[model samples]
Target: MSGKIRACYACQRNGRLTCRRTRLGEPCLKTYPLECVDLLKRSRVAFQAGRTLKEGFRLAQLEAVVQMLEEHECGFVDALGRDLHKSTTLDECLMVSEPLGVVFIMGNWCSPVQTCLVPLVGAIAAGNCAIISPSEYTAHTAELLHRLIPFYLDNECFHVILAGANDLPEVVELRFDHVFFTGNRKEGSRIARAAACTLTPVTLILGGKNPCYVDQHCDIAITAQRIAWARFHNAGQSLAAPDYILCHTDIQAQLVQALKCYLIEFYGSDPRESRSYGRMVNLEIFNRTRDMLWRSGKVAVGGQVIEAEKYIAPTILTEVVESDPIMQQDVFGPVVPVLTVNNMDEAIVFINKQEKPLCVYAFSKNNEVISRLMSETSSGSFCSNDSVLQSLMVALPFGGVGASGMGSYHGRYSFDTFSHRKSCLLRGTRFECVTYLRYPPYEDRNLSLMSWACTLSQRSQGWCQIL
Candidate 1:
């Protein structure tokens, strides 16, 4: 039946499903492909049956998910490593996150497993049926999730569709309670538009060119190290990572030299040989990032690219102009650009002129400088004296604004996103004497009494205050 994927798990073979999406005999699917609208309809039926309404049911499902994570813990780590070159230390960020209802979660490439499981797990915790659409870009990790999730989760309430982003046009048009997505602004806009047809609520954790500002009065060495770590993490393909830097004219040269030293100390002379650094997830991303080299900025360090291995060294550019195309686009790779700003005002002006970012990083010992950025600009999240570290705090909500995204999740926010609060009232059967006073009366006394009863019951100096 088309309801369930009949494709063999070994060969990923199924003419019925593969024929519609991809060609024959090419390992067409890395995971089992199922119709998304069908799953949404099924989940809605389950929701209507009040199956997911109980807190016990919600916790049990979450426990089962925890069990799955425990059982296949190594598989997830191994798969992510193969896909993103993520190390054990770097893997901690993905482990943190939590969700929404009969929901569809569209995962992105940079942090594939985290993007998929975080939202799905949260939905289950909130007692909502969910169907996960892990990104096809991270094939190995997505395939592994395809195999494990069904065995661990309830198939009737929880589902995973092994398909590409292209498959979602049909899914979005259908009436879904909610949709949680994490990706680029272009795709996020499309998802919002599609979801709008049904007036379905959506949580989009989209990306943009997040700005990191370095002031003259701060410690350049520590600033350089932290910025390098944040920017180069996962080979600098992070949604919240600093896209470009604004340095005070006085400290520009010092910061660059400090960044240059940290690059060699952290990733070695040739970063390609380093295990901690990651490569491009796909050719399309690599092509986009590789083209940034053509712009008219000085590559301060690490500009090498190996097309065959999909590796780009941790590179930094200086003297970058606002007119450059790289400044306009989200450089979702390990490319960092530094532009000189006269002072805090110029940096704030530059940041405000662009679309609101997912996060803003400001490094300064001066509390006033930090406060100015915090108060003057708009972003999904803000951190003073740090870079992209705000996302690591599970207590804080993470999402974007403007071209970045809308809706937020993490901690209690995740539960609130998926759980629709039903305002309830309980009335007693013994109140007939008081209740009957307001029912179908044609007397002035009855009307007066009814009005008095509806008013706020209060006493002034032990006497009734009803007017």
Candidate 2:
């Protein structure tokens, strides 16, 4: 468990590992060999033995997880701070459902702790054996979890595998009851394809380019402040953050000015000097984000990028078009692009033309404006007059729609995601007379009686009541 391992050059060579450029030179990451088949066998054996099925056992494991988080809070914080340069914390079932035997969870790098632990929590609560692979890009956090999880949870039932992207193809080939993945669309597609070969169920939480509309009727200052906070937080690494702004042309200038002021207040004149702001996860992300900032639109606000720091200032791009490089992909950085539209209808049309997003946001004081945006546009979720707040609450089920993602999870939804609702019915021998009618050779009278019994009718007026 010593932190003396070498940097994972293998991870960087793979095209899939895009989130791994550390600020102060890459840290050494501990990776495991591809022993997934044996691990899956162990998990299956544990599930069959019914060790995880017991309520007491599940509760104990869950409690252990809470204790582990509490005991090693600083360690986790330090690991995450190193992995993604995060500065803050974010804070998530159901039916007569049983465990889905085993769950395979692949966490994302944006919020490594949350993406990994939230699904793990649900899997444990639902009484399933789980195998988790934290993002290799988030090396420190992944290695820390690999070390800490086995100590807290049952090593046989809940296992952590820290492997590079090259190992994923073989890992997904092995069978599991359910597969839960939080990542980009390309990698998620590959996982889906592999899972499909085994006919395994999957939940993909893929991030997309979420759009936010700014109406002339809204308070520009408040709207700008909320957008800036939501967009610039975590260096705009959040999947739920508003990707681009669609503002009315008349108020576009005002909104841009307001956003500039708020950005200065949130991260000071120089965001690179601000401790509250974070850096990109890796060089790949930094380069991609920087390219978008340079190729698209005029830089109305911060558009600075320091390659060595893997830093992109909290930037705002104006005069951006739909075809811009930034608009084409999920701008998973602290860059907010603005596209001016003549009105709400034009904005709606623009939004509808693209893939549905994780969430759709609209800022307006008018209730009708909010209602129109919510009703007309389709997304995983809709937030009015604000951004990124809808997915924070555990009460809300978080997910994406269409190309964005599939399935929801948070609170009870997570429990459901990892569980199989097995319907059951028990009857006594004494009730044999109630089923006598349909047991014999079928007759017209029997059909009539069955139909009457099944019909929904008022009391005392139906044959069901008489029976």
Candidate 3:
């Protein structure tokens, strides 16, 4: 292994050093240190090649890849759980099914199953190579992915680099044709800047403060049950899950009571003992959630904490103001803040005041309420009379708008993201007479004759009505 590592370094140095390193000597790897020029060249080649291939071919290839990954469901779920400490089989399929190009940037919060599988599926379908850089925080998942990816996919085409945060700039300098990043807004901004140097295309899926609305007419029992399920999923590590709730004043207490009952039913009185409930990703996230709980306005229900296990019970707070810290940031944890408003219109206004969220959930049976929310507010997607189920629909496009995210991908959208459309125009050989009249050289008499002929044709066809 040591000899192979040395040879790999030699390869990076353009073979300046000759070693007695054989194929058995640690499997010397070659690194392609791509630059802006390389990126432009590759993009041009990909665009031309892609134009020739039919979209149907791309879609079929991606579907086959997703099916293969799904077959190894246990391997994927285990890798994610080991890396992120809390992930499910469902999360693995949801994250990995949408693939991108060969190389992509992913966050620590995401499991290796998602970080590697998602872009792997996309890149292979697009017929592009990838350089994957997993998050530093999730070292175990990163290592597992670095080890397992070569076994599942072509090793030469897919490369995984585990590096420190400071090394990201050097890595980004490689000039990928497309940069697909999933992380916080601050880091996503840095990635955007780095990709901007080469004018490379980027798809950023960043953080969100998604709001859940509970209307007065909503069934309190069903609304609370759904909210509890969404808020506690993966300890609320999801970007599209409801971060806060906006309820009509008339139903606030009823909703709160129902929420309390559901929490007990789902996680029990002692949530730390519940196997279904998950913990925060790490100590830092636990501390952040703890601080938000302390500084919040009022605790409505489920404020229990288990610091050792990084567990914060499915918490709900009331009287949360716009200025509060919990309300201001993307509360990516098991805490749900409830704010009361007079009516549905006021709820829409409140949501519009903030940056667009990745998802929005409205618990209302009225068709008018659903229509208004869908048409008036801008979001990545929305779930009517429920929460988080929109993400389960593989057929629908999933992503955020404005500050939340830049592009979307899911199922067919994944194929579209990786493929470029080429326009073609076919001219007929039989239309020779009409084509001859369009030639440049012409005398005044000829021009007048052509104009008169066109006028007659137009009059005969009733062109005025057509115009």
Best by lDDT: 2
Instruction: State the lDDT of candidate 2 residue by residue for 228-264, as single tens digits.
Output: 9999999999999999999999998899899999988
The most accurate candidate by TM-score is: 2
Q: Each candidate's lDDT (Cα)?
A: 0.81, 0.84, 0.74
Q: Write the per-residue lDDT of candidate 3 for residues 92-182, one digit (tens) a residue.
A: 1112233334456554564446745665566667667777778777778889877887788777887787887667655676787777777
TM-score, candidate number 2 = 0.76
What's the lDDT for candidate 1?
0.81
- In candidate 1, stretches whose alpha carbon ends up further than 4 angstroms from where it belongs are 1-101, 428-467
Query: Residue-pair clashes per candidate, as listed?
Result: 0, 3, 7
Question: For residues 310-336, could you state the per-residue lDDT of candidate 1 as single tens digits?
Answer: 999999898789888789899899999
Which run of 10 residues does model 1 get worst, by summed lDDT?
A: 87-96
As a whole number from 0 to 100, the lDDT of residue 8 in candidate 1 is 40
TM-score of candidate 3 versus the correct structure, residues matched by position: 0.71
